[model samples]
Target: MKYLLVREDDEGEDELWGRCANVEGLFVDPVPPPREVLTFRGCTPAGPLREAVSRPGESTALLGNGYVEASDDTQVDWWELVDAVVLAHHPSRSDPSLVDVVVGAGVKGAGGGGFRRSGPSRFELFVGNNVSAGQSLRVDGLLAPRQDPAKIPMELIGCEPTGRLLSALRRPRKREGDWAELWALDRTGQVMAHPAVGLGIDGTRPSVLGGTLIDITLTDGGDDRPAPAARPVWEAWYQGVPTVPNQWAPYSSQGRSAWLRLALHARRPRRPDRSGGVHHLDGRFVTDVPGLHCAMSEALAGPGGYFGWGWDAFRDCLCGGFGLTPPFTLIWHDADIARQAPADAVSACEGLLSYAEEIVQVLEDVGVTVVLA
Candidate 1:
């Protein structure tokens, strides 16, 4: 089995220790030097140094093995020498031998250790067992190969209630470009419909809603640039009293006529007695201003009733002339003809729209509610 040799202190280098015969020392020196010594690393036996003591000839041979010293001066043992060599080769963190060293050194878990500021961008740790949440650990000297944050198996530690443990291990959220690329590849829009997207709306732009986030930067033309800020626009919708359907074809004469008929009836006042006295005019056949005038004059005509086609005349009639009373209704069908006037009458069409809006506003002011589709 492979072993990751780790250093006991920062004073020396780490190395890989294994059982092989080509190493410098392990067997006793012969009367005549052999071609090579049966050794592992700089020591002999090519195996766990502890096992050499149990074996008969191995113990005697290893005692004379130059790598191991029984003297108190060096304080070097066969096992310690093997550990140094194994760690020098940089074994994987998951190696059992490496794990033993780290755990034996008092590190509670894989990432649990105490940390201290070493520099502006770097920190040092005194890794040992019993590290608490929010505390950093140092495993630099214990593990064969140094572990990078990205490659570390952070899930080995259970999640803490305070979440600091996981936060310390987790990678930062992906940037806007990365998110957008992911979304584009999603094909299905389900990712856009996620609830998190809505929650993030407060921090996002309107253009990016239902899509991915975008990073935006603003400058104030200064050397000391400040962080960018954005103000969001909000919109609202109100459901007023229900009347006619809200669908209308503004480009078609017939559709406009239908709309006018519905609007007029929707705005008609209800009598206390609820009798059928409301005036309604079906002007679907009326194409131009003259035809419109003729139709209105005939429908509104009563005792001494006289209507006109001009804007001024129409306004006057609506104000109470033409023998029409308040609380009355005029269902003007096909009123859209004026709105869809010929190319030569574009100005007239615009004027018609303006007049209609004004007229609707005025009528609504007098308790009339027009439902224009």
Candidate 2:
């Protein structure tokens, strides 16, 4: 495999920065959530706080005092205002794990005590104890590194020192907003992964092969890549290898997801919707989420056409310009293959209903008459 470094110039054109004989630190883990400290005030305990204090290691949500003015929004869950889990409670010294600092205590019925703007609280929180949606997404992990928080570290081995790279190294220090993209390519020069990165130059030295070795750190801006195991699948696709139906069925859930992601990224631009006609989706191989996507893409726009990668993306496709507008008829031949098959792990976690069932409903909802045969 070879690596290429590229950058987008002011005109938004991709300029090749240089090519590397070898590159390291492309694969990475997702960035962890930022640590936060929250403090609550007052004194008293409606429910025994001992349960939380007893199990310091276990995570538990801290509830609101129920005294604040309720929001007019009907969707609000007032009962559980702070949804994050508590990592450590510091009031009691029973557990030695907690940091020695009492910020606030969970006071039970501090009569008429609304959300205080300022005052000494007896509780302090850290890390997982703050408001957050959830952990970093799995896709993020494949795009960047997990060092110094959310930065990617890379060492370019035997780099063909370009004027651009050499000039950057000669600078006294890196300027703000130094950025580039690292692309991985196969032996046949097919691009595999390309991720936008914020570059931090470490140093540069001469290589044994007369090339320069440059070490740098990178922060992921975003990327088009997949897990290592799934690269072969994409490579084959790039080589125009015939895809046997259900070819993706045997891959692991993560692999299937990677395959689908790469397919979505690699899909051809949406062609104008047909004026009028029926489209037939070959559903014989629709045994998994990725397969469903592959079959659907080919069905709508011919070979290698992309309709959507998932329900949301599919809905977007149905809105228009994806080779087929709404109100079209779709004959899903051998649809039972999808109906009877268990969903891949990626789809199963999305919802209880099978993805096939959801796909049909989405189509029908948008006026696409689905003939499940």
Candidate 3:
């Protein structure tokens, strides 16, 4: 038996129906024919065609706008007609041990009339834990006989990952705001369409991945790049006295200044009623970009009054060897103002946040507690 899959166009042309009727094969046309040619309306021939295609009976030739013609000796299998790649894997909502694999590709609808004239489509399938991103596979199994052919469910039979698929996954690329193109490739290395994938970190590096520093810079401004500077010397206090209890604290002598007050609230000391050790850092600062930089530099100034104003400088100070001591808490007041800064300034602020996250991760790795509020 043979099957023909014809897609409907916007103009409502039904020429393919005539071709299917004249040919001595089973026809699976989704678009309704003219009323004079066929009285059936909202009726589709998907059920019979799906049964004919999947049952282990006789050889078949699957013909369609997107389908390739099967050879004489080759048995027609639904899986052989479609190609897909694993986009991501998550624990199945129904079962934990089994993973819910998200696969995507450009597949023609099988029987249902719900096929869209789009390139690549995404669907989820349940698979074993062995399945992972970058793995390519073929679709096999039966489609449910329904009006919406697009809802056709199929099983993914694993196949070796193609070199192109692996290469694309290892260095995924986003084109024209689409990440789907990274995985929607045919066996012959042809890309179907650009699709989106949530695979990369959201900010410029240095990034904190699993508590380790990723030494990659993502900002175009080069703010996180290492710069040549004098060897950092550590200092604990200034003029043999802790700086005033203002926002600038003991680092005020270093030319570090903030527009807000920095007050250290003492808690009950370890010994009953003496005094509580300073427990947490809490404060706010100007939300503007330039103000933010100045406030941060002043708040984190080191012993010699040295405070770097940019991400590179801040990172150096956080890694010790500079003047600022570890186990400190920083309370950033009015931090939300940065969001309204100019576009370029907003980008710089994001880079600063990235650097801060990385620094916090590194400090935590060494058991040094640093809190940013």
Candidate 4:
């Protein structure tokens, strides 16, 4: 089985580790990430990486067998090895072979990006409302009267949760025209996601999936042990985590950050419950998002012809509810779901649809039309 598959748009694979990997990092695999899933693998293990084919300087990721080579190592020399074995990261400003750079692009399953034509979406983004809903659906040659959407990449900037490391990762080396980070290549010889951390612990290698993880820890840096939030160790798994923070939680501006994304997601039930892992969450996940019924593009086409009843069927939500994720795009061992771990986050448009409904219903039940997005 091919462990790594390139996601439709992302330069990296849609990793299945958890919200960070599945949603944020984009680990490619057979299945898509689920809404309320059980994360199986924590960090990628080594053993399998060293056995794979490799390139000149690129090595493995600190996480596991997934390969980790910088996709844009176009310098004239062998700097990748120096950076990989020394600094541990090499950032790529633009994702390679990007065909569609769009936002607010999509058609169905609740709401997220508008589904239409594709464009150069450099991710000038907002979690939900920094701009308008269906924010200017920019695509192949569809320019508006007063706007140049072409500047979306430069004009609207979204923050990656890892902004703190950008400088160090993108730094220029003493060698002119050389990148600050190392470039990794896969068995098929492709540039993979930059691991960012864990280079040179003991001669790292690359994985067929793109990169392998080195067993290293940088969280303990800066004299005193940094807080848990700064570390690379996966967040601790526990039962009863809330679907949203308890109102007073501090939020990071980089909404896509793993920790922040999990907050808005559904809470997974603990062990010993009858629901059988997350299957018990069936009925609870669905709810209505404000203006959900009104939010569709006038051109929705009505579920292929059901009309009033067809539109109404969406309101019923027979499938998974809003916020609740579906079966994972990738599952680690067929058996042993526990090893897969509980899902605490979501990103799929389908899963987000479940959430959109849930939010709408929550407001409607209170007799308050809180929002229409």
Candidate 1 vs candidate 2, TM-score winner: 2
Give the top-scoring candidate (TM-score): 2
Residues 171-251 of candidate 2: C-alpha lDDT, one tens digit per residue = 877644777877766556766557666556765667645633644443343333345666556555556423454455566
- Which stretches in model 1 have alpha-carbon errors above 4 Å? 1-276, 302-305, 343-373
Top candidate when judged by lDDT against the true structure: 2
For candidate 4, the 10 contiguous residues with the lowest summed lDDT are: 148-157
List TM-scores for all candidates, in order. 0.22, 0.59, 0.22, 0.19
lDDT comparing candidate 1 with the true structure: 0.27
Q: What's model 1's TM-score? A: 0.22
Better-scoring candidate (lDDT), 1 or 2: 2
lDDT of 2 at 282: 88
Model 4 alpha-carbon miss at residue 127, Å: 11
lDDT of each residue in 1-373, candidate 3, tens digit only:
0111122336855212110101110111223211111011111112222222234543232221122111123232221123333333444444454333333333433333233324333222211111111111222221322232221111111222234333433464421121111122222322211112222212222223223222221112111111111001011121122343333322322223211211110111222211112223223433333344444544554211333444454555556554444555455444344444444332221123432344345556644555444
Model 4 C-alpha lDDT per residue in residues 1-373, reported as the tens digit of each score: 1111121114543322100111111111112112111111111112221211122364332111111111112211100001111112122124322212211121112222222324322111112211111111122222212221110000001212133223323444211221112222223333322222121111112322243321111111111111234222112111223223111122221211222223212222222311112111111211222112212211121111110112234443323333222221211112222212223221112123333434335334533233221
* Ten residues in sequence with the least summed lDDT for candidate 2: 134-143
User: Which residue runs of candidate 2 sit more than 4 Å off their true CA positions?
Assistant: 29-150, 174-177, 184-193, 205-225, 238-247, 284-287, 343-353
Model 4 lDDT, full chain set: 0.21
For model 3, the local distance difference test gives: 0.28
Superior by TM-score: candidate 2 or candidate 4: 2
Model 3: residues >4 Å from true position, as ranges?
A: 1-285, 288-290, 302-304, 348-373
